[model samples]
Target: MAKMPVYLTTPIYYVNDRPHIGHAYTSLATDVLARFKRLDGHEVFFLTGTDEHGQKVEKAAKDAGEDPQAFTDRVSQAFRELTATMGFSNDDFIRTTEPRHKAACVALWQALAGKGEIYLGDYEGWYAVRDEAFYGPDELTERDGVKYAPSGAPVEWVREPSYFFRLSKWLPELLRRYDLPEGHPDRIDIQPESRRNEVRAFIQQGLKDFAERPEKLDLSVSRTSFTWGVKVPGDEAHVMYVWLDALTNYITAAGYPDTAHPRWRFWPADVHFVGKDIVRFHTIYWPAFLMAAGLPVPRRVFAHGWWTNEGQKISKSLGNVIDPVALVEEFGLDPVRYFLLREVPFGNDGDFSRKALVHRLNGELADALGNLANRTLSLIQRNCEGRLPAEAVRDASDAALFASLDTLLATVRNQLDQQQFHLALESVFASVRDANGYITQQAPWALKKTDLVRMAAVLRHLHTALRAYATVLQPFMPATMAALLDQLGVPADARDFGALATPLPEGTPLPPPAPLFRKLDLPA
Candidate 1:
């Protein structure tokens, strides 16, 4: 069968700071999806990198007494290092400062300008430099003689010669696109039903408000106060808005301007994974920009929620920002990866607790799955002389266990397709728990003394189920699963979805069993 192409992306992370656990959360989720698609026989393109150009970046660079390019180059490398550190399987890592990306941004600007969707205007509003967004007066809150954006980022009044995109003109089209029913072919699928509702509400409100006051709906798409970003196509005095440049990185990595570029086939990306805070830029401004440029909009945009450290908001002042590298260094990479997705539903805010991490590490990884694998393999090694046991006449219990294994992949596929990582992991581990129960009831060890034939059949059943578990789980915990598969004597080529249909050959020699996970010591 020909491979189906699927494109997935992690929002290009801002380069103003080192990578944190939140960045890892999004990248790991995207990585797991890409790995799953590849193992399931699809051609996948996974893109992630740093968003390098913006007023905030320039200010941070100045604070450090470094040139903006040098500053971005240094911080961007940290993000690149992170992909490796986390074992991310991205096909491309694109930096906004790359020449191709800058060119693509320029072309997109020209396309919108040629369509007369862009025009010169004076931008007078309350802007939040920290957010790189504008807030209407009604959205601002006052405290102690200070004004703050809805995000609590302080705002400053600004007036500048800027370019504006005819955002209000496309409000009706955006509403139509977002309002398409759930199963509509061209529906703009914004995930976590709550987020989809939020986008819908914003659009409906914008349309209602636009009829009363149209000027307030247009978007400022260029800035005169920042010189560290993509320059306007014809107006060097202004730079494209940080968002315009940043969002274009999605298409730039897919060969935007050169539609004939081989990788351009991946355009109109299958999904763009972003944090909830930026959903407006993606679901609203991004699609409108694509429409103005006569380009295809992405099929879906999933906005996942934030993470807090020990029930407190993660902040620099709080000094509780979770460093992903440190977490992986303290706990194994796969454990951290597994804990992040398994601990919470993908779209809900979750707390990063050491107690929770240790509990999952000890209970799920070490006790449940690992103990099952070790016990089953050790029994075969000791009784069957380190060989895979041959199957005997099956029983009703055997039939029931295989029934669940048969449907495992389909069940996981449904959950993952909707970005439900927690549910998918739950499904996989549910089988693990079942297998554990099967072994306890069968007592294969005691059966070895009385009914050798039944013992062999019981061992073979477990081996078959373990192969299925490891095959499906390789995406979430690659290194650990690879080791597990190796211990089972599974050929490296036989690790994909296709191999699940062909069980391990009976009597094949297996390696000595080794424990996959060690119980973590609890903190005092």
Candidate 2:
């Protein structure tokens, strides 16, 4: 049977700054989903990259006394290094500065123009360089005679010859496509019920009002002030707006403008993972662009929340930015990965603290899961001659435990499909805690001499249960789980979701156990 195709993406991080925790969070979430799909027998195409063209990058380059291309190349490499540093498995890394990406953007612009969805015009409005977006008068807040965007970024009035996308023309069609009742098959799914309602309300109210207001303006899709972006197809003086170029990266990575590209089969991404701050762009503007170009919008846009640093907003001025690489170096990679998704619900804001991270590492990873695997494998090595226990009849307790393992894959599948990562990890650990309790209650150590046969039966059951846990956890903690599976005497080929149905052969030789995670000491 042909494998099903699954495409996933993380919003390209801007190249004006170094990679930060916020960037890592979204990419990590997307990586987890991509890894899970692959393990479940799907052919997945996962993409991530840098957005190197924008007014911000140009200004940042001038400030540093370097050419824009040189500056972007330096910073974009930092982001690319992050993928390797954090163990991301993205199949491709795209850059707006790349030739292929430029071609795709040009192709998209020509298509929209051919459809009469874009036209040359003079743009006069309040624009925010920090956001690379235009704001209407109503959307700006004034304080002390200065104007700021809804995002709190200060704005400036600008007038230039630009190309405008006929966004107002598509407002009704966008509403019809995205404003439907939840669960409609054709609706553009924007996740986290709160965000879904937010997008829906914006389309029904905010966009409607913006379109019908006296100006009756369309969206500005080109900029003449900065020479840092892709140029409009036939207009050399005007560069395509940074957002337009940035958003086209999704299809570009999937081989856009060349539908015959084998990878093009993964078009219409399964999901796009973006930070909450940019949900408006991904859910609204990107869809409108694709619709105007007659291309399919992504199936879903999941906007995840931000992380605070020790209960304070993460900011450069505050100097509280959390560096993901530093965290991974201090704590092992998998433990850091585990704490991130486990510490909070997927779509809600979270606080990152050294105290919280340490507690989860010492308490959850070392105590709950690591200890369970350590003790179970240790007992099997010492008592069962470093091999899986021989076949033994099961009791009611063993039957109940196996039943839970039987349904675990389906349970995790459902949770992940909804992108409930925290819930999925919770379900996995629930079984881990149960296994811990079972080990304590069964007292296989005590039964070693009195009832050797029953002890073997108990050990066999636990061995099977541990395999199930490791298989599902491979996506979240790939390295640690791979090591765990290696120690279980499981074959390399027998580790995917499909292999969960087959138990390890009885009396298979198993290697001696090693502790997977060490308990961390609280800082003095």
Candidate 3:
């Protein structure tokens, strides 16, 4: 059978700090989708890595008295390790500092130049190195006696000789493309209705390609200033702008600008998952760049909201940033993963709290799903000789469970396709809740004493139900699901969705059972 090609990516993390809950959330979501697609027999290509070159890294390196390349190497390794620790199965990790990445960046720049999209120009504008973006006067706000970007990054005025892309020239084209349907190749995530109106308003006020000098602009190919980034193709004096250089990492990871490369099928990324803070850059500038280079724009750019700690924005400077590794270690990996995806609705802002985490682990995991597994397995061990029993026929309660499973599976696939991860998880929990209720009503334990045949039928139904649940959850809680399947004596890889009713033999000896979850202890 020919499989569908599926490509997924997380915004490469900036190597300024170690991974956090925000990073973990995004990567975990991508991993779930990747695993699900692969199980469904898709030709999956998943890519993730560090954004190694930026002004922040340059300054951090200077402060530490190390070359930028060496500094980035250490930081990038830390980001790479996150995939393994979190159980990610990424196929490629491309750092912007790689020679191949540099080549792709240079090639993309030349491609744009060949199309007369780039030109030499001097720029004098407000540059926010922290955000790696230039802001016009209108976008700046005065706060606490300092100018800041809308996302609160500090800004500074600068005048420099640089090459410029004719961004203004593409405005009409961008708007036209943005109006296309959701999955169009030319449709990049353009500005939102309000934001698009704002951009149009700015253009109506008279757009200017160069903020300071237009007539006597001294634009050149190279600059002698930085050795940390990709050099301009013909002139080594200038390096590509960080924004220009950073965006190319998306395709560079897929072996872009090289059609013959083995991993090239993953180009035209299926989705770009980014935080809301960088929506404008990803949605506007990135698509424009691709269009200029005559490359296909990505299918979608889904911008999710940010997380605040205890109702306030998380910041290391303020000492409120939550450590994801600490949370995972303290309350197991699946609990943290489940809480983050379930607590927040995708694409909306949310707050994180220790109290909420404990509530979810205890209320949902320990009390609901964990108890469901314990009761089902415990009954099987006592009545069915610690072995699976064959089911002859399903009764009313069993029929209800089967019906619910059908709904759950359908809804889960729907939610995931829409990037509504939390909604998908809710469907899983709904099945858990329903199955638990069905077990309670059927009373398999009670039937074993009087009617052995009825008890066998009930055990068979429970085993089939639990097996289906575990299969559905394999992409989300892989470790726990594997443990559950191990107790059932089924191999991990054999638990894919369609194999739900394949049935264990009539008398298969079960492995030792273990608690699927430990309840979190709430502090006084």
Candidate 4:
């Protein structure tokens, strides 16, 4: 059977704020999936970029005394720099203001308008400029002597002339479409039935039309009033709304408005990874726009939860924000990747604590996996004269070891396919722990002098096992695995899952090995 094409995306980070751990988390998750899909033999397309146009960005640019474009360009480069530092292999980096993206957005807007799906009207509602969101009064709540939306954005009343999408018409269809049979790709992140029923009941009671407004509202302002967004096709009176402009990037990155391009084949995205805070924009408004334009809806919108630091929300004032680059430089990238994935279950809120990070890194990464590699390679160096042994007969111990690897690989592959990355990493580490125990029990060292030939064979098998182990770890720990493979003398391109269960020849000279991880000390 032909392998299915897998397209993955991380929600583009807004460039108004400096890159943070939250941005890193989303991109890393997408990178993990892209690597896994490629290893699974799928043609994968991965995309990540910065969302550069919005009111927040305009305000930020004004505060910095720079053009919004110039401000975004600098910050966007910072985000791009992160991909290389974090070892990401995204296929493309798209920005909202690019000519191709602007054309695509204009075309999509025209498509939706031509279909009688958009109508100009007066829009009066509570708009949160900070959130770049428009909200209904019912969704407002008092907090700290001020009204705020659930997303923590302050809301204010406003009335403006806006173009409205016929969202109310599709409420039933949206709910029904998500009501597909179990095991469907989209069913993975469908709202709970109770919540769905509540939404449905609310819609049944009465549904309101949704108006799309430009990032900067028009108030007979001069042409130079707002200079931060895509020009509104022919009408210079307005620029595209940030939500509309940002959302079109998914298609724009894939050669939108040009079906001749190869990426157009995957135009309707397979999955969108977004924070739950924007679920309404992704699940509700995005689909409505696509449907209005006679375009296919995205397959799924999986909303992941946010992270807090040490039980408190990460805030600049609180000084609890986690800097991803700082963490990567200090702990090394792989350990940070391993801890973040293994420390929390996907789709759930997680706390980033130095203690939790240290415990996992020390216990799982350093003690379990790092020690296992060090011990095995040290044995081979001392006993086998630093050479891998030839494959030997299927002894009971060897058979058991191979059997365990087969099972673990199977489970790891399955968990990765399901996006249960924590479970997948756990499964692989469990195998490492087991391998460590097996080595200690077999005491390959004890047989070194008395049974030197058998020792050679055993060390050879262990060396081969480590190669396989490192291959499985490449996605989550690319730098470390590359180093591990270098020590094993495996060719650079030979470090994939397919090389498992195959042993390099005996007498293959091994490179000098170094410690994969160092025990980190807590700062005083």
Best by lDDT: 1
Report the number of the highest-TM-score candidate.
Answer: 1
Model 1 poorest 10 in a row by lDDT: 391-400
Sorting all predicted structures by TM-score, with the top scorer first, yields 1, 2, 3, 4
lDDT for each residue of candidate 4 in 405-450, tens digit (9 for 90 to 100): 7677678788876667899988787777777777887788898758
In candidate 1, which residue pairs get closer than 3 Å at backbone N, Cα or C atoms, i.e. clash?
none
Q: Which residue pairs clash within candidate 3?
A: 121-219, 222-237, 222-238, 223-237, 223-238
What is the RMSD of candidate 4?
4.1
TM-score, one value per model: 0.98, 0.97, 0.92, 0.91
Reference-based lDDT, residue 405, model 1: 79
lDDT of 1 by residue, 415-500 (tens): 99999999999999888888988999999999998998889889988998888899899999999999999989899999999878
lDDT of 3 by residue, 255-296 (tens): 788877877777788877777676666766787788878888
CA deviation > 4 Å runs, candidate 4 = 143-145, 182-227, 398-400
Error of 1 at 117 (Å): 0.9
lDDT of each: 0.92, 0.89, 0.78, 0.77
For residues 7-65, write the lDDT of model 2, one tens digit per residue: 99999999888999999999999999999999999999999999999899999999999
CA lDDT for candidate 4: 0.77
Off by over 4 Å in 3: 183-185, 189-227
Regions more than 4 Å wrong, model 1? 391-393
